[model samples]
Target: MIKHNIGLTSAEIGGLWEAFFQETMSVCLLKYFLHHIKDEEIKIVLTKALDFSHLNIKKIKEIYSKENIPLPDGFSEKDIDLSAPPLFNEPFALSYVYIMSRMGMINYAFITANIARSDILSFFTNALAQVTELYTDATTMMLSKGIYDRPPKISYPKKIEYIQKKSYISGFIGQKRTLNAVELTEIFFNIERNYFSILFCLGLIQVVKDKEIKNFIKDGKRISEKQINFFNEILQKEDFLGIISVSMEVTDSTISPFSDKLVMSLFHFLNSIDITLIGHALSMSMRADLSTFYSKVIGEILLYAESGFSIMVNRGWLEKPPQATNRKNLESR
Candidate 1:
């Protein structure tokens, strides 16, 4: 039903549709965070995030209106209770903002990279800037609050050197080479992200009341812990310290601050991103063992994603995405 001259492309529509739904969920979660957050500094960061989410939702609505497309029924105030007890402590909430902001930057960058339309491109560029600032502010706050776990410091190279041996990429035999900087960066980044996922899952498991969903989240936590230890063992083998855990940052809370749908959606999103990142790491990995391990882990995560989708579908929580017309059905008719 779109016009040829000025109508939005499918890519633009998909990007905006996904963004609108995510921003709506972000608004609801941030609103709850703002309500229960006691630290003024962290509160300020959450407020900024909430403001951006609200603005994105408004802009997306405008685009839909122009295109004569119906808006998605994303999360709203009805999906959250502001008066509920705090499910996550301030430090955990701060970490949540930091992690979510980082993901937001990745998403906006991806959307902007493929965009063609002038308005859509500009919208995502502005969104990228906002999320970058939000990430900066959240990380600064986490550091000031002493909740950030920085990567292990490596010594400066005595001098720039080029690869001189094939062993640099070998892993299936004798005299395997030590980890390179690129591989180490990817491993550490993965470990740190999975660490965050563990804590996030732990908090969610404690509060989510649905037995099935709670068990699914527990599987997520277990997977994260498994991955965390596997990656950490890699660094520890080199006598190098790894990023420590932040699971203790989560407080004991049985009350749910977010709806089950929001919690699962967040889990689904995080796991999906992890799959993408793991694929990148696998592609860059030179060691045969590491590459094989990443491939197996990816399969595991895909299964996990399938389970999450099932939960969402059974509960009638999953939103239907736009799809191409079924020409076969038309022909049969």
Candidate 2:
């Protein structure tokens, strides 16, 4: 056991703080979903996800209690209403778990690499394994149910060749080359994520009670649409078919099943994910036009995320994360 005499390092503190908030939010969401989900396959996935989330929260609480750090006021029972009606259908729920599990895997991998505390690293390591299984199961179920959107297939290359010309990356002035498989894959996956975001915002906008929150959701939907158009147009120009909309998955339920705070928090999280995905796309995109477009899109998403954060702060809904001690101020005092 780690000595309680030694306090947590900054990296440990930050990682635990972030994990606490994220897992807490996941717990609330999973609980709500568990209440409404009827499909056996989907319910099983949700149950497992909820279990993992609770376990993570408990582990973090133990660490906090040992270290004498105040626990974060993450989402709790008040943040959700178990009696609320179902907001998403079975397929949507499964797809959500699949996508979130994928993101969770990425997060846990990062957390596992960034911290020094062996205990915290071990916790996240297990978390990653759990989510990896969840993703596998969810994807298998989705494919069986014919709900999974498989990426477009391309013809196999008969021969491999090296790029001998400097013009391969040029898209601004001369004949732009057809999108390679890597670029196409990135663009397609990015647009596919935006479609999910747009549908999520569309559904939430129909039920959110607060006008400010509603408008924010609307703004998010608009941005998703704009990004969708931007990326889809690129595919269109290349004569490649684009992804179909998942809006049909959302129902016409006008009842608010989630608290406005929960909804806003989800929006904030999604916007952050969007920025990350865009940055990844920007790095992988070789053509100048795609690179420039991804850069601009990232800027737009950053502005939107900032506005959402301001709203969260003004409403007293933002929970501050752990920070380093202000040594200079403490010394002056």
Candidate 3:
């Protein structure tokens, strides 16, 4: 039970870069293993992925050593059966990659900022650039083959600004004239994050494979579910306010941002979104006109954000950091 402290570390940032590769391999291999029955091309693809995973694993090990951080017992042959059929198929596999690459980019942007130390922060900046490049390459592959699931782009706005498809996702709220697109985005974004937390935690439990990883994932799942329901309750309270007439909706239909990595990517994206919403809450809280309940909910979300990051580490989705860096990040401001 890692006492899940707060804040960003260089190692964790690097670790996520490595984790993305690990997860990418996991999905690619899982899909090929299940469906490669007699297809030479799919087998070739699986072999190439296995090679990439092998190389990336070595690189990650080097990163851990460089940071003077111990690598947790990560995945191995014992955790999977090459002879066994894959639990996932092609459609889902592609979806997972597409969304997650976008999600990975978003998180790296945070890791770059959230990590204040020089060397550690540089590690993330470098990783972010590399991951961006990786994403671009993957996107090219998907585009060439016509398998990528692009994100929902908000079309260009005309009359009032750069608004696009957000209109469908948003609606007019009541009394408060200030509850425009930004406010509407906050509401639905918060709801989607809650939903993502629930689903990501659940998806993690399914393929954790290792004993420590599996138990950790299950524990995180429970925590995430509680937080999701908490957010849902808070949004319901917001409905009681005169801010807007539009009702909040948490649509469970998850969209694929990456070809196959939607689940993991959405999980990562939602975690980042929670942080953004917390910032919004804080800014709103400082206002003289904001309600007391909104401020309280902001306080609650702050703690829940800490918990969310903790669960990510516990599940091995987020890498643990070096003690020195960890201590500094957790220390009082």
In order of listing, the candidates' clash counts read 0, 0, 24
- Tens digits of per-residue lDDT, candidate 2, 169-214, equal 8844757988888888888878778788887887888888888888
- For each candidate in the order shown, give its overall lDDT on alpha carbons: 0.84, 0.82, 0.47
**Candidate 3: tens digits of C-alpha lDDT, residues 1-333:** 885434435546554454644444454444444353354533444444445445555655675577565665543344334554343434333333434444556766865666665545665676566556555655666566565433223345567655354333233343222333344444444444444444445544555445554464455456555544554554455552212211222223232212222233334445455556556654543222233444655565555446545655565555333334457666865
Which parts of model 2 have CA positions greater than 4 angstroms off?
1-6, 172-174, 246-248
Clashing pairs in 2: none
TM-score of 3: 0.45
Q: Is candidate 1 or candidate 2 better by lDDT?
A: 1
lDDT of 1 by residue, 1-333 (tens): 885577777789889988987899888888888887888888888888899989988999998998899999988888788887877677777787888888889888888898898888999999999999999999898888777877666777899898776666764466556787778888888888888887778777888888999999999888888888888888888888867866446667788878888888888788878898899899999887688889999999999999999999999999988887899999999
Q: Give me the displacement of residue 208 in model 2, in angstroms.
A: 0.9
Candidate 3: lDDT of 218?
Answer: 59
Worst 10 residues of 2 by lDDT: 242-251
Which consecutive 10 residues in model 3 have the weakest lDDT in total? 242-251
